[model samples]
Target chain A: MPDAGITAFADWIATTSLSHLIAQKLWAIPAIQSVHIMSLAIVFSSALVVDFRMLGLMSTGQPLSAIARRFLPGVWIALIFATISGLLLLIAEPVRSLPTWEFQGKMLSLLCVIILTLSFQKLIAARAPAWDAMPGVPAGAKLAALVSIVLWILIIFGGRWIAYHAG
Target chain B: MSITEFLQALESTAFATAVREGAILFPFAESLHVVALAFVIGTVVFVDLRLLGLASRNQPVTRLTNDLLPWTWGAFVLAAITGLSLFSSTPERYFTNTFFRWKFFFMFLAGVNMLVFHFVTQKNVKEWDNDPVPPTPARVAGALSILFWACVIVFGRWVGFTL
Candidate 1:
């Protein structure tokens, strides 16, 4: 069983006016969901390219910084959208959302994803020129890419299960 | 057979039975589908963005497409497999859903958009391959492609909720 604090929080969210409005509106959930999914595509696609480069899978001829500079804007923009939509979805039905194991798991993965992405970006920025010249990226960089991929997969896994598990 | 019959037949198959009935299988397939979609759309964005003259301003278009298209094709195949699996689980519902229809229609358009670029504008690709911005035709193809795929993603997500 979840702790008492989580249950109380879930109870409080269940009574919110926003949650009631979301439940009443026919189009609200689907519209928000569409935006969320599109944001997923944008964020994942931009990150996938950079990660692919880190893994030595593609863009072998280009420097890491060169490719990253091209795609990071898309990533950041999409991430902002994803965060907003995700929060909207959460507030729309936090009672249903908060009690679920899927939500709990998704939050964990999301936390890891943010940390990994930020740190990896920092690492790339710090060693931009040196990393670009190397034919093979550092082992650490590849490991970060792999970990980021795995965390996202976990996020997707938990996300797809949220509805099924939600109270 | 009628269209409904066709879809029903698809859903009635042994594979579909497993997909629909197996608790773990459906969600697992969904996760796979999301992963594949990320790769397909992600790689395609590079080509589209480059054609738009938005990113990778210095890279040759041919070089970018050559390096990226292979991975895109690979991911496309994976997406098709996972997508088919998802469809099989609820063929009748999906067949009737407007969102699903829009998704496929836009997917077809994206395919045609790519073909036109490959066969027509790409014929003279050598002339503008190194140009900071590609010519009008190439840019149009890129822009249309981005539009079609964006619609595809929007519709694909809507299908889940609508169904």
Candidate 2:
């Protein structure tokens, strides 16, 4: 089936409608764009802080939990922006974006990131003693963090290129 | 094959077919690109601002950049690859696009700007040079760096509008 066919496959029916509805709402488009940028700031800044820790360049001495606690707010904040921005963008042109290849690739990678981040939260970071022990970051934990970081990076680039793709 | 042919080769392949078909796979790729770009650019701006004395004044410039360099490089490398991938799908269209033309062109200048910063100004940091306020030359370079990146983003944003 073609891309249009896939959207009509019943499973994608809800997603299709949601995208169309959002795209049609004129006021929502710019609002989401603003939110998306704000969220991006939080996400990127917070992640870089952790990345620095992973490489052992900076030590706050407060522990990984503390750092994570502080930055997590940022992560969530940025995520909200991303979601809102994405939704609004989708709202503007659901059928067009719904069928595009870049849009699908972005979604798949996002799923992989979400799963990894949630699954590893406890194992990589839960077992520490405050400033004394810090988070007992495992190799796997660091690896997960690293992967999450890299994937997010790719997602943004791809997202920007979507418009170019259509042209 | 010509360079253009090598790049456009993807347009003629199954991937392109799937993309044209608007499969789930294509949208996912596009998302990844946007996310990566924000991370990379955000990181670069963060580091660049620190260099120019915007924030992170207590930290060493050399350390700031060196520490974050890998992430920056990672972002750049991935952005370039994905960009090439994107270009592959529409060689002629992009080749003729004014914004596309400026994007690659400015992207090149930004890369050069980065290189010049490291080689030229980075050398002075180790010599007990502390400038809560950057010196004249450093300030100039810093100003230039900031402007260049802003253009990179501005031009990048407009690429969509114009193209």
**Per-model DockQ against the true two-chain complex:** 0.63, 0.17
Write one digit per residue (lDDT tens) for candidate 1, span B97-125.
99999999999999999999999999998
Instruction: Name the TM-score of candidate 2.
Output: 0.60
Write model 2 residue lDDT over B67-101, tens digit each, in one string: 56676678667767766555555667767778667
Model 2 regions lying over 4 Å from their true place: A1-42, A51-167, B1-10, B13-22, B128-130, B158-163
Clashes of each: 0, 46
C-alpha lDDT of all candidate models, in order: 0.84, 0.61
Q: Where does candidate 1 stray beyond 4 Å?
A: B1-6
> How do the residues A74-162 of candidate 1 rate in per-residue lDDT, one tens digit apiece?
77898899889988888787766777889888889888887877776788888988899876588977988988878887887788788
Cα error of candidate 1 at position B6, Å? 4.2
Assess candidate 1 and give its TM-score to the true structure: 0.90
Which ten-residue region of model 2 chain B has the weakest summed lDDT? Answer: B154-163
